[model samples]
Target: MPSQTKRKKPYSHFRLRKFLFFTVPFTILALFLLRTSSSSSSTASVSSSYTTYQPPWFGDLQTAQFPWNRLAFSLTNPPPKTLKLAVFSRKWPTGPNPGGMERHAFTLYTALARRGHRVHVFTSSLDPFLKTDKIINLKIHPHGDAESGKWRYNKAWELYQEENQKQPFDVIHSESVALPYWKAREVPNLAVTWHGIALESLHSSIYQDLIRKPGEPRLQSFNASLYSAVLPKILDEIRFFNNYAHHIAISDSCGEMLRDVYQIPEKRVHVIFNGVDENGFTSDKKLRSLFRSKLGIQENSSAIVLGAAGRLVKDKGHPLLFEAFEKLIETHSNVHLVVAGSGPWEQRYKKLGDQVTVLGSLNPNELKGFYNGIDIFVNPTLRPQGLDLTLMEAMLSGKPVMASRYPSIKRSVVVNDEFGFMFAPNVEALTTVMEVAVAEGAERLAERGRKCKEYAAEMFTASKMALAYEKLFLCIKDERFCIYP
Candidate 1:
């Protein structure tokens, strides 16, 4: 019995040793492998997401592959007299994201369509632009980004050119300087208008100073290589600008910018100021009061609502305006500011929160209501923007304008104490202008509003812009004057 007990004890000790030495290590090893495998799987999923989407155009979809020298299409069918017009842009007008160029393109297209012309707009995606069940009228094509699975406009242009080899339209309208086109040689009477060049845009005093901060990698070291390399290539294409069928400028200054920078002949550069839908901006006092009430303004208070809209960037002069507004509040009572739009410096303007109403972004109709409610419209632009559609809308809203006298604005907006006031694009100058305008009282403002409406009706209407573009397209079709004037 003693011998049997000793044997059992040795066997039990062996089993205990095995559990301590092997089982614990094995369990830890299994957990480590599981964790590693999970991490690897997640990484693989992320990598695969970026490369999967192929829109109609980008890669293997070459529409037209003719050499640069050979541009004209072989006439398989007779071309129409009025010409089938097509305009291609990188993006379209959609609220706060919509810049002047996009609105100009849309208004031009809508006007053309109204005049019995079939206009097709090729865009990447309408995600943020506008939503609708019926997109049949616009012919929008969706192309996804290479990694994000989203469509890109440049890629769509490549595909459209490849698919439509016959040069279906007499002329092609291109908004960006960087789109693919068919028939490099004949060039199909393509009309290209630049919103404005970056070379000129970044040369502004504020932007130049911001990029030159100490301890910062020079702007030259960062994105400078790209602009340095690509812009010259883009500008070299400008000889074709004046030579194209019609070159429309948003303002006389924009036309001059092209002429001076590109040496584009004056004959080819026709000034066609951008226009707004005046009918859409018509306002009534009842509508104005309703909008003001919703915005929390008391009806009896002598509340003066001053509003401005644009990207919240320094170039738009929000900082300067804020400074001026703070100063104005010292002497004025019951003054309120309504700011609409978003940008990088959204938080910087918070100090004026109580005195100012920050309505981030509003739709076209909402903007019309806001404009009508405001006592005056202020455009404080630190950069050169094309004919600002917002300013035009404000003018059409029957409000007086206090705008920056940038060269572009000076050429486009007429300034009179009776109609509106223009100030140099600086804090002191703008402050003085606003102070005077605000103190001028209601009768003077009403007279100014009347002139503002008349100015818009005379110059910045959609019909006038459309007619100018049509005439320009006709000139291009006829090959009127090949060289710059």
Candidate 2:
């Protein structure tokens, strides 16, 4: 009886051990599945909420009693008291083919000067024939050799100092890192607008890697130096950012990153979205017809013209666009693609024949005409950094966008899903969105464009952006002017 009791005890212990081995794993698997399901539900809810979400600033703009709204009106009506502004831009727009940053500097300072401010731009040398200082209150002080197209920051700084000695600048603005950290540290009233930051570049590197094809060359090599190099560079940048007095983020996501990830003080960081020339890019039906006719797309035909502009490089997601559009044209014969801008992919797009129109790099006026011609604007960017000025330009031109679902674009430009369609950074996702746009047809797209134009008019005009910056400059000059009202 004693031997049997001992045997029973050993048998019971063995059974207990077996139960735990199987039960523990089963329990873990159940919990993981539950968590995944919950996460998916949460994502769906967030997406549904986006359909009704209007940006808080848009609400303020709509309210007549809002102080910011009142301020916008006041700035344009009689204009604010004249300010002496110093702008440090590495390169100023010399002609119609300036890059985005140069275009931004030109648009902003020009708008500020038009409002009666005395503005001086310290930049690299321009072409001899290029006419500048055409605006009454604006002047350009070029500092480097025009032949090399090399911008000398030291020379520009010397020019700025010489001018500052004559008349102190009310506010100094630096486009990106044009003003070096050493020089920036000494300027108390300086604000630097960050078009792109190192941390964003790190994320972009990772994003690009995730979507890379099986046989594609990894230019970013994200996994190889993620901890070894990228992280250390980001840390160095976070430390270097402290040298500047104030930071201006061009997108909402960038602003959050400045305060949270970069650990910059909340008061020192400001978010002012990039704006477009509203008058130049507008919804003109006659112009639209004329441009489309030139493209050989008949108005009466069922054809839907989709346009994409900017440098046709890999980072612009042209590879994904090329693949998606190729697949799209196979199934849908009525859809046509018009590409502006040029790069390595120009020849590839031209290979698509009559269905694709490769316009190459266009001048500002021609770019405007291209915008009016398209029923939908597609921006398939893989690098998620600064807000593309093209997005704003397209919206202002009264065209709905089909852009990547990056946080910068989703939060800032397409806050409401009604404005445009967004897809993940992959060929399958892009192709799906393109198909949806085709199904919606041109007339339905026009309705979306109208809504997009209305929202863009209130939010993305040069006047609004200039007014916001003017207010910030005023506040920086005098703390008493910092009051919201």
Candidate 3:
């Protein structure tokens, strides 16, 4: 009986150990699942609140009180007072990105400086531009690293406050993408330029990868690849946008977004088109042939080359472009694709297995030659990103364009179909456009390209954009200076 009892005790102990092992794991997994489910539900509630808004009461500024015409001024002519300006940008012109908001800032600041204004730029740059650290001329101040953008903003505010005490500033302009909410009491006049709005970005990021609008939100997940729909940053923007009375919209579509989405009054939102480096992007016949040869295009073959350049992100529609090219090539064997610029999507693009040339990001000198080689330039973006400098670069180079029908792109640059083509954001829409672009006669395409070049030169120059901004600054600063040029 003692031997049997010992054997039974050993068997019972073994069974107890097995049960505990499974029970402990099961309990942990159940807790984890519960926490995740609860978090998801709470996040969904925040995201859903932003899907709609009341009209008019929500800042639908259809009629602008300050209607300054663009056609009136070709240059930013000073009106008696050569005002002191304080500009804040997270980026500068010297960086790898010679386009976008930074490029606009550089052009405007340079133009303002050339006109003899005491322009000081507060930005995040290690190797700040300008030879001398003079207060009279155009000067760039290097603050904190851009990685800690919030820190930079805080420091920028502190710097602006300190500077204002020494000498009063006429206007303070901030990059609207990440404007510090209010600080209105500290600033007498503040204007923020919008590149892309928050809500629109949040809507796209649900499916689009690495496409957060403002700064990245405090994420619920450990992986940056997977983001929760309940964006903490976006929820904050729902309130933050209303803090400013004056806003600078980079395009008409941008202005409309501010007025309708954020409910900023039309009078408060100033629409200004971005400019391209005209001299930097002119087409060269010799360089065109050289670039074509480099891409392995046969001299005799009637190959219709299609080109695209920019950050190859999800919102840029790289997958759609590659996939559409595959479909478009089934019958049109005389077609080829050449893309300049590299990003996360390069690995995927490498697998397309076609006559595609990936010219990683080009230098300023290389850009002119690159545009010269391509027959058509395409912008297959999914998001309504204000406007791409690449598209303007392409147009200015006398190359025809094919772009997504985003309102901002359409209103700002796609003035008419004569200059370029606009397709809905889908593989099918793109496939159709590419097929037609390939099928179009050379003479007709050249005619369209010529029109694009002429129009872009007239409407989208740095001088013109700067002039419009200068007028807005004057209008806001003094009532008498608001007189139309």
Candidate 4:
């Protein structure tokens, strides 16, 4: 046979040697992985268990019992033993805003300062016209640079807290979003005055955009991005802010929204409509013609001159205004639309190829001139309305108005067909209403406008708004001071 060699029997020692060669590294690796996993699990557990408590900015004022809960008052009473006030804002009106909220802030600051109240405005420099006794301009990175810019805003908020620690204010009055939430507990008394509230899906979207980007295309994002991205975040923030403070609603609708959105206690919310300087928005013939002439508008043109002023964004119904004007033009040969204010969609709306006059923007004094130049003023803002200062000005100007029948506008500003026409938000309904308004003519419309002016003169005047706020502030302050006194 082929000389087969006897195979040696395998020994346990030889098998052990082979096993060690293979198993040693694997064992080491398993142990290393197990150790690593254990460390990771321990870290995660610690992280999960740790929680930080952030005290509310406002104390439990509304929930306080008896006389303490009731707002104290001082009508023809002595000045407080100790007076301290805190004002919060996000942006002051400095550079390029259409001068709505900034003007209100400047006016509020000046008025409060003149009254000898120690008013401090904590805000961002994004506002162009804001200068006051005390201002905290939070540093923020330039727009679109989120990574670095975020830190700036974070630092600014931290600075606000750090600075407030030096001297605690007796009362905190905030105009911007969520300051009352952060500062409520730190301060004794807090009152937040809202400029607007988010009621609808669209309103919520817009507010989130304002929170994210103060200006530009982000503000103009519509149905696609609004529903897809903004809606959820806005809902979250609204819920957060609503629960954060003793919320003040600027309009009746806002109060209702607060009640509906957060189930906020009825006692915690109050409606305080914004007011305008009635004297500044007067109707003068010479001023009217001066502005009309500047716009190449003939005073004698039989056309129904309709004016829509404010930022020409999609929501403001600038496109709808154009569509309505195009239809109204077919019926009324003398119809002209003058648009004042500017935004991202200005050129796009301008390209609609209508006979509408885009006046871009006007100064405060000049805005009155523009209002006077027109026969009827329309506030075609789309969703979730409050009182736009322009609507107040239009009412003050004795020019008949046409506004969207949104809850806030209808409740706060729009009285009736007597004051202004309340129409549907769509183009067809708005266009049909415009036709009726054009047919109403200047004499009848001016009469309605006069009534509106009277209403505004008595109710919506700045003096009236200021006096109410003063009373409310003094009442809160007196209560807080009395506790210590």
**The best candidate in terms of TM-score:** 2
lDDT of each: 0.63, 0.81, 0.70, 0.62
Worst 10 residues of 2 by lDDT: 61-70
- Give the TM-score of each candidate: 0.71, 0.85, 0.77, 0.70
lDDT by residue for model 1 (56-164), tens: 2221101211110111221232223455666767766544456677777777887666565666666656664456344323444444564322336566666666545
Predicted candidate 2 versus true structure: per-residue lDDT over 1-485, tens digit per residue: 45654346658988999999999999987985566455434332332233444233333211111113113445436444678999999888877678889988988989888888899999888888877658888999989655534689899888998999999999999999999898999999999999998888886776677777789877655556887788898898899899899888887667767876799887888777778888889888788889989988887978999999999998898988999999999989999999999899999998887899999988878888899999999999888899898998999999999999876777667867789899998999999999999999999999999888987887688888888788778877777656655
Clashing pairs in 2: none
Please count the clashing residue pairs in each candidate, in the order shown.
21, 0, 2, 13
Q: Superposing every Cα of model 4 onto the true structure, what RMSD results?
A: 17.8
Report per-prediction Cα RMSD to one decimal: 22.1, 7.0, 12.9, 17.8
lDDT of 4 by residue, 419-477 (tens): 77888766778888888888878778778888888767655666556544565566566
The residue-level lDDT of candidate 4 at 142 comes to 23
Which candidate number would show the highest lDDT if scored against the true structure?
Answer: 2
Q: Model 1 misses residue 449 by how many Å? A: 1.1
State in Å the error of residue 281, model 3.
2.2
Q: On residues 1-485, what C-alpha lDDT tens digit does candidate 3 reach at each position?
A: 45654346658888999999999999987985566455434422221212222122212122332112234474534646677888888766665655577777887788777777778787764553433334346877657646422237666767777887999999888876434775753565778887877655754554354333457674556344224443655556656776775787766655655765567766677767777767777767798889888888876667888999988877788878988998887787788888888898777777766677787897878888889988999988877767788888898899989998765666567756687799877788889989888889555777888888876776667776766677677766886655543
